[model samples]
Target chain A: MHQKRRKRADERRAEILAAAESVFAERGYRAGSLAAIAEAVGISKQTLLHHFPTKEHLLVAVLERRDLHNLGIVADMGLTIEAMARLVDLNLDWRGLVHSYTVLSAESVAEDHPAHEFFTTRYDRSRHALADSLRAQHGDRLPGGLTPDQAAPLIIAVNDGLQLQWLLNSRDVAIGELFRAFLATVVKGEPPAST
Target chain B: MHQKRRKRADERRAEILAAAESVFAERGYRAGSLAAIAEAVGISKQTLLHHFPTKEHLLVAVLERRDLHNLGIVADMGLTIEAMARLVDLNLDWRGLVHSYTVLSAESVAEDHPAHEFFTTRYDRSRHALADSLRAQHGDRLPGGLTPDQAAPLIIAVNDGLQLQWLLNSRDVAIGELFRAFLATVVKGEPPAST
Candidate 1:
């Protein structure tokens, strides 16, 4: 009975996170409220507070729950250009995750914003990790002669920039393909013969 | 007396827009408040309402006020790879425009967000214009081989994606230099020789 009760709590928490994700994505952390998120989950504000305690806590939880599958792939595969292409392909199916991540990350750029530190550290770490991975695999310089440190941020920028485009206009763009095209030139192989 | 009053009103409206830009950049449109913006400019909500009349009107005023110098450059130079490089150089000095644009464009991706149509049209026109420019200059295929429409969005993605990085940490990266490095491969020339 205790195990079943614990599972129920976990399920409720997951549902709350989903509600919070959409709320934060649509309204943003500062404007999105507990009352609205609670109402979405069909619960009272008191019960929602019992689960999250505060708005900041809920914001943190929603951010932490972002699908880290692509990052994990980067870690495992060592960020080979092809690996990035494959990873982007996966993001196509995860629209909710993409919208929330893109919206929240941009909103987090302001100083003192709830996720500001998280994003600052996250970008720092991602850049460092990518540079390290490229250096480890390609040895200090990528195929095109740029150093790992220099190339790392460009790669990150492309990923993020493409997300905004794809989020706004999914019907026309093939982000994975576009990313692959960008990566080919950076990674120092023959540019693809055709689009 | 009428002339003096007209000039003062224009100045006051510009001030309100600047305050609104920072407020929206920090808290986002839905979350950002008129009262805070009014207070920042040392006025009451009633006075602000008199000037703009509604929150959406204020949002429109702020969005419209964003510097379009970059787009203007693109138009004059016909999307040549070099024109983009020069364009990015200008954005580095326009940090206020950069922050508000980066934040709000991402937020506008949500369904029915007020600026959603604006961004959608902007990207569509930019991509079309770029493609037309590239095709006219290069004759159906860029030196690197991708058509202009194909490369247009990628260029945009890098510009935006790099803004996030720079907005977060301007200390380390030179977005213009990084952009040039990416453009080298896409535009099909020798990559920069050194970091």
Candidate 2:
């Protein structure tokens, strides 16, 4: 009975966080509120607070959920260019998530923003992890004189920039194909031949 | 007397727009207000309204002003790789403008955003102009079988993406040098030789 009750509480918390993600994505963190999140989850603010306690805590939870999701996808696919292409393919199915990530990241560039620490730390962690992973996998054999360290940031930048363009005009930009070509250039030390 | 009054009005309008740019840069467009802009320009909100009747109108004028400034710089610099590097160098002196542009562009991705039409049109115009200028200058000689058209978006993406990374970690990311190297990779079809 205790296990059953604990599972129910965990499920309710997840639902609240999910609602918070949508509200924050649509209205932005500064404009988003617990009241709106609670309404979306069909719960009272007090109940929502029972799970998150504060807006900042809820925002952190949402970001942590996304990080875990993203890391899982990458790990499942292996740390290859193919993995990145797959990520882009996945992005197409969830434009909301992409928008949330992009908006929060741009907003987080301000030093005082609540998400600043989250994103700065995120980039640092991702860049170093990717660099080390690439080194362990490919060593110095990568193309274009790109050390794993160099490729790490460039790859992350392209992933992000392409999403911005793609979100603006999805019909014109082929996110997966473009990312694949970028990866090919890195692997071959030259731009891929036009198809 | 009429001529003098008209010139003064124009000067005040310009001043107000400049202040708006700074405010929107420091706080996002949605969070920025006419009162703040007026305070920045040492004018009354009533006077600000005389120049730009609505917040959207002021936002549009601010964007147009920036567009004009950017066009003037690129025209003077001749649209070469060096020109792009020069732009990056220029960015170092105006972190606020860079932050404003980055934040606004990301926000403008939403269809209902006030800057939506402005940014969508801006990208279309820029992409076409860059493609045409590149073609006229480089002909079909671009590396990797890339037409000027193909390279335009990629270059723009890299430019915008690099700004984001640099903004987040200015001390570590050498924006101008990194851009120069990106240009060299395009020019030579390979990474530039180490100096």
Candidate 3:
């Protein structure tokens, strides 16, 4: 019975996270209210609070849920085109997660935004992680003559920017195909001489 | 006397656009109310309505104001690295404009958002314009061997994506430098063998 209760609690927590993600994705972090999230989950605000004490706590959980999926994709990831391709496919498969992440991260640009610290830290870590991976193999320059430091964030930017475009208009843009072609230019091609 | 009246009217319009862009940047389109924008502009909601008529009208004006600046940069743009570098520099100078555009454009991913059609049509045209420019220079395949159609939106994605990263954390990322480096790989370097 203790095990059963624990399992039920975990399931309830997940339901709240899903509701929170949808609300945040559509209304953004600041505008996405706890009340609206409770209503979406069909729970009272008190019960929702009982599950996650603060909105920031809930936001972190939502971000972590997505990151957990991404961890699976990028765990021990190489700078290979194939590894990055899987990450692209993962994003394509999870539109809700991508939408929430893109909206929250972009909105977090404002200095005082709640997610600002979260995003700044995350981008820093991810850029370093990608840079470390690139450095391990390429030393100073990738095929395009950019240092791992310069190339790492730009690669992340391409991924972030592509999602916004796809989110804005999925009709004309193809995220996966475009990402693959871009990786082709960056990861291979003859190393250019210019800065 | 008539000329003075006309000049003040234009100034008021510009003021409203600036205030509206700030509000929209912070709160997003759906959540950004006309009253808040009026409050920022030190006017009444009625006066704001008188100027824009409706929220959609205001959004179009804000987007167009940004587009006008962009048009000056890309009016006779070629697929050269130099022409694109100027645009990267242009965005770096316009932080407020870039923030608002990134926020609004990302939020407009929802089909029912006010700026949906506006962004869709604009991206469609921009993608085509970039593709046309690239095609003119490369015939069918770019220096990186991807067709203009395939490469065009990715260039846009990189620009859009880079802005969000810079917006999130200006400490580490350099938009202009990264963009020029990426452009170097795409516009020059040897024609790559792969897609």
Candidate 4:
């Protein structure tokens, strides 16, 4: 009975998070409400509270879910040149998701924000994982004499920086092309190809 | 007499924005209030509203002031290797200002945000100015084979991206060192030296 209840609770939490993501993505964090998220999940406010306790908590849960989703995509692709391609492809594939999360993540930097710790850890892990993969792929042959830690952040930074540009002018700047250029420059030890 | 009144009004507006910057920096956007800002400026709420109209308008004004400040800094430096170095220096010199603006800028990405247009234009102007400077420096050399337009966003992206990382872990990374390395790589048309 306890196991069945646990399974049911986990399922409900997942459902609520999915609903919250939709609401937050559509309405943004400030405008998104717990009541609306509950309604979207077909749950009473009390039930939503049982799962998330507060709007900040719900926001954190939604962000965590997205982070896990991103990590899964990165992990499944495995560490290869193809993995780099896949990373770019995945970001483009989920442009809305990427855009929404980027905006929300930026907002999450406020002191006392529930998602602050989550974002910090997520950044650390993502950077480390990508760096590890790159190290594994090229080993001693990696150009630019970059350690995994330094190179990892550079890759992450490029991804984020390019995303902002893409958001502002999507037609002119292709996120994938930028990412590809970044990868080529790092791997080949060349300046990015002139536009 | 009319000129005196206009100058007085501009001075009062500047005072309010200065106070707003402090309040927002200390308490963040969500917790910051017009009342708090008024108190900080030693003015009544009515007097504050006379100048700012609303808390959101005040926030927008603060952002506009910051954007203008950064633009002025970039412009004063002129476009050359010195300008790039000055950009790095200004970021370090005004680290607090940079942090405050970055945190607020991230929050202002909401679709209907009053500051959205301001940020968009600020970004465009900053990028274009940097690109123009870079073009002048190269004088048709096109070292990386990339146009200034293509390379300018990349440069901005690295700076912004690195800022986020530095904010997350200032102890782990030296912002100035990273930026200097980045500028060296871009300006010298070579990869970063292995260190």
Candidate 5:
């Protein structure tokens, strides 16, 4: 009976999150209210509070859900440069997911935000994972002095920097092409001497 | 008489914007309120509204002030890849400026945001200027097929992407090194060959 109750509670939480995401995306994070989100989910604000306690809590849950989904994709897949590239491509394909969260995450920088630690830690974990992957694949091919730690940040930085441009004007830019160039640069183990 | 009134009005407007920026930075966009900003400026909400009609207008004014400052920097500078690199370096050096504006800009994506057009146009102008600079510097040096338009977005993307990591874990990452590496790759003008 306890397990069944927990399952139902979890399902309800997921429903709330889905509704919140839609509302947040449409209204932008700041304009979105707990009452509106609860309304969308056909729940009372009191019930929403029972589940999330605060809007920040709900926002963090949404981000966590996304992180879990992305991490799962990376974890379950085979390790290869191609796989890494594909993972990034998947992120690009879900531009809306990236766009919505990025906007919210940026807005989450205040002293009281619940998602602050989550975003900070999320970035750290992503850097470590991507770096670890690079170390594993190209342990033998690093340029004269480059280490996995150095390469990892570069990789992460490029991935992130690309997303900003994608958000601004995905209409004109090919995110995949840029990622491919970055991957090739990494594989070659040196900055290209010339284009 | 007109000049005196306009001068006082501009001074008041600047004062309000300074207060608003502080409040917005402290509280995040959504949570920050016009009343709070007015209080910070030691003015009534009526006075604040007299200077700037709405919260969105005040926010856009703050962003415009920053962009104008940046544009001033860009204008006094000559066209060259080296100048572009220096501009990137300058931006990273004033990392707080980038962090504050980016955090704020992300929150300014609401459908009715007064700053939405400003942010969009600012991005467009920056990309165009950077692309033009690259083309001027390396017109013939680019790999046979790559154009500045193609390369400019990639550079902008990397710069923006690195900001997310920088904002998250400033201690573990050196944004400058990664940017330098990227600039080197761009200056070289060739796509990295596959291993």
Candidate 6:
């Protein structure tokens, strides 16, 4: 019975987090309210508070949930240009999640924002990981006269900047195709001078 | 004197807009309040409202003020990579404006955000202008087998992505230098295959 209750509690937490993501996506991190999230979860604010003691905690959890999903994808398929492009394809199914990500990342730029550390660490780890993967896949010498280190940030930048553009008009921007094209330019083997 | 009063009013409007930029920078577009902006301007909310009717109108004015500054720069110096790198250097002095711009641009991705249309129009105009400038500067072929039209958005993406990263840790990321490096890769002339 104790194990059964623990499992039920875990399921309930997932339900609340899903609701929180939708609320945060629509209303934005700062503008979104815990009360609304509770309402969405069909629970009292106190019950919601039991799971997430503070709004900041809940915000962190929401970001962690996204990180977990991304980590699983990268881990299962290794970090390839194709994997990153596939991430963009996955992003289309959940525009709200993408919206929250863009908003929170920008919001998190402020030193005092709750999610500030979350994004700072995220960028650092992601860039480092991508750089490692690029080096591993292509050996030390990469294409376009750029090292894996230099190319990593540019690829990450395009990945993010494309989302902002895609959000505005998905019809105009083919996120996956454009990303594939971007990859093509840089992955054409080392430049003539480098060679 | 009516002329003197109008001049004072104009000065006050400028002060309020500057204050708004600072507040919005620190607190973000949606979370920052009109009351806070009025406080920063050393005036009552009523007086603030008298100048700009609503918070949305003030947002428009703030964005317009930024555009005018950017326009002056681009116009004074053509849309060369040097000019853009200079713009990045200029951003260092006004971290607040850069912060607000990043946050608002991300926020504006949401369709109903007050700044949504403003950003949408800005990207379209900026991209078009950039593409035209590139074509005029370089004939049909661009460096990486891309048309000027294709390169335009990529450059803009780098510009924006760099800002987001720079905001997190300005010391580590030399925004201007990084952008200049990106320009070098893209301006190296058409790929070997393209020829």
TM-scores for all predictions: 0.91, 0.93, 0.92, 0.84, 0.83, 0.93
Q: Which stretches of candidate 4 lie over 4 Å from their true place?
A: A1-12, A25-31, A138-142, A145-147, A191-195, B1-11, B25-31, B93-95, B139-141, B193-195
For candidate 3, the lDDT comes to: 0.81
lDDT of 3 at A183: 73
lDDT tens digits, residue span B22-54, model 1: 888777788889999999999999999999999
User: DockQ values for all predictions?
Assistant: 0.70, 0.55, 0.47, 0.44, 0.40, 0.46
Across A166-193, the per-residue lDDT of candidate 1 in tens digits comes to: 8889988789878877677666645654
> Relative to the true structure, how large is the alpha-carbon lDDT of every model?
0.82, 0.80, 0.81, 0.70, 0.70, 0.82
* Candidate 6 residue B161 C-alpha distance from true site, Å: 1.2
Q: Candidates ranked by lDDT, best first?
A: 6, 1, 3, 2, 4, 5
Model 6: docking quality category: acceptable
Of candidates 6 and 5, the better by lDDT: 6
The DockQ for candidate 4, computed on C-alphas, is 0.44
What is the overall TM-score of model 6 with all chains considered together?
Answer: 0.93
Local accuracy of candidate 2 as per-residue lDDT tens digits, A10-65: 99999998888777777677767899999998999999999988898998898998
Comparing 3 with 4 on lDDT, the higher-scoring candidate is: 3
DockQ of 2: 0.55
Off by over 4 Å in 5: A1-7, A27-31, A92-95, A140-147, A186-195, B1-6, B92-96, B109-112, B140-146, B189-195
- Ranked by DockQ from best down, the candidates are 1, 2, 3, 6, 4, 5
- Per-residue lDDT of candidate 3, residues A8-122 (tens digit): 8899899999999999888778788999999998999999999999999999999988887778766667556688878888777778888888878878787877778988899
DockQ of predicted candidate 3: 0.47
**Measured by C-alpha RMSD in angstroms, how accurate is candidate 1?**
2.3
Judging by DockQ against the true structure, name the best candidate. Answer: 1
Candidate 3 Cα deviation (angstroms), residue B32? 2.7
**lDDT of candidate 4 at residue A159, scale 0 to 100:** 75
